[model samples]
Target: MIAIIDYGAGNLFSVKNALTYLGLPYQITNDLEEIRRADSYILPGVGAFPFAMKMLRQTNLIEEIKKQVVEKPLLGICLGMQMLFEESYEFERCSGLSLIPGKVDRWDAGGLKIPHMGWNQLSVKQPENPLLKGLQEGDSVYFVHSYMAYPKPEHLAAFCEYGVQVPALVSKGNVYGAQFHPEKSGEVGLQILRNFGGLTK
Candidate 1:
């Protein structure tokens, strides 16, 4: 079973619905034991970085999640993905899970718009990355965010250009991150989730 961690700040139901549509077994919970028992994990969130991190700390799932990801795959979506970085500048200088080497900060956006929302085509960086297995040449995904991660090129699996190049997908070892909401990205999104499901095997 895959654990859909509910730390009280996630877009939990949509992610759950997507997983259900894919027929993937999952459970949404904040219980530590259940998290430890799952084969993989999905950390879905939709909120400010500081607030979300505070919630995770309050629920005491930080250390356990850190431990679990060392042995099992973990996918962080949107705000959840931001939390995987070393720190964020959303509301204040806050520490993140530091699973991936990067920092979250507001992108310049080149004076286009504040939050670059809507569909964007993913420019694959590392085609051989397993999470991007079946993705096509021009596969696009939905994005809705203001802040973005500035990660090392090696960790970036795919990216999309807005006013700036946003990190769309990132992977390091068993951990993966999607800056866009794959659950809402249509067929391309489902294919991404399906690829993620294939990671456990």
Candidate 2:
């Protein structure tokens, strides 16, 4: 079973529906015990980074998530993905899972819009990455975020160009993150999730 983490974030219904459509068994819960027992864990979020981190801490799932990332395959979506990094400069100062050495910050550059909304093509960095298995270099993925992650080059698995080369996907060992909302990225997204589901070992 895949555990879809619930911490009062948004757009979880689409995620749940997509997983069900794929005929994959899953449970949405904030219970640490249930999360730990699941074969795989998916962290999905849509909101501000600082607030989300606070919710995780209040629910006492921060350290539990750390443990799971170390022990099993943990997939993070959107804001959840951003939280896998070392720190974020969203609202205030906030620390993340630290699974990857990086920082999440707003796109303060000139010309480009702050929130990069809509579909964008991905440029696969590590072709051998299981998360990007059958996907090609220009596969389009859905994205809706004002901030993005900046992990070290070694940790970057895939990227998408939007004014600058944004880190679209990243992974370090068993911990994985997707800056785009794969649940809403149509066939390509579902394939990514399906691949992750198949990684239950």
Q: Considering every candidate listed, which one attains the maximal lDDT?
A: 1
What lDDT is obtained when candidate 1 is compared to the true structure?
A: 0.91
TM-score of each: 0.98, 0.96
| Candidate 1, residue 84: lDDT | 93
- Roughly what TM-score does model 2 have, to 2 decimal places? 0.96
Model 1 sits at a Cα RMSD from the real structure of 0.8
lDDT of 1 by residue, 1-201 (tens): 889999999999999999999999899999988988889999998989999999999999899999888989999999999899999999799999999999999888777887889989999999998888888867878889989998999999999988878999998889999999999999889988888888764
lDDT of model 2, residue 199: 85
The TM-score leader among the candidates is 1
| Residue-wise C-alpha lDDT for candidate 2, range 139-192, written one tens digit per residue | 999999999899999989999888889999999999999999999999999999
* Each prediction's whole-model lDDT (CA): 0.91, 0.89
Q: Which stretches of candidate 1 lie over 4 Å from their true place?
A: none
RMSD to the true structure for each prediction, in A, is 0.8, 1.1
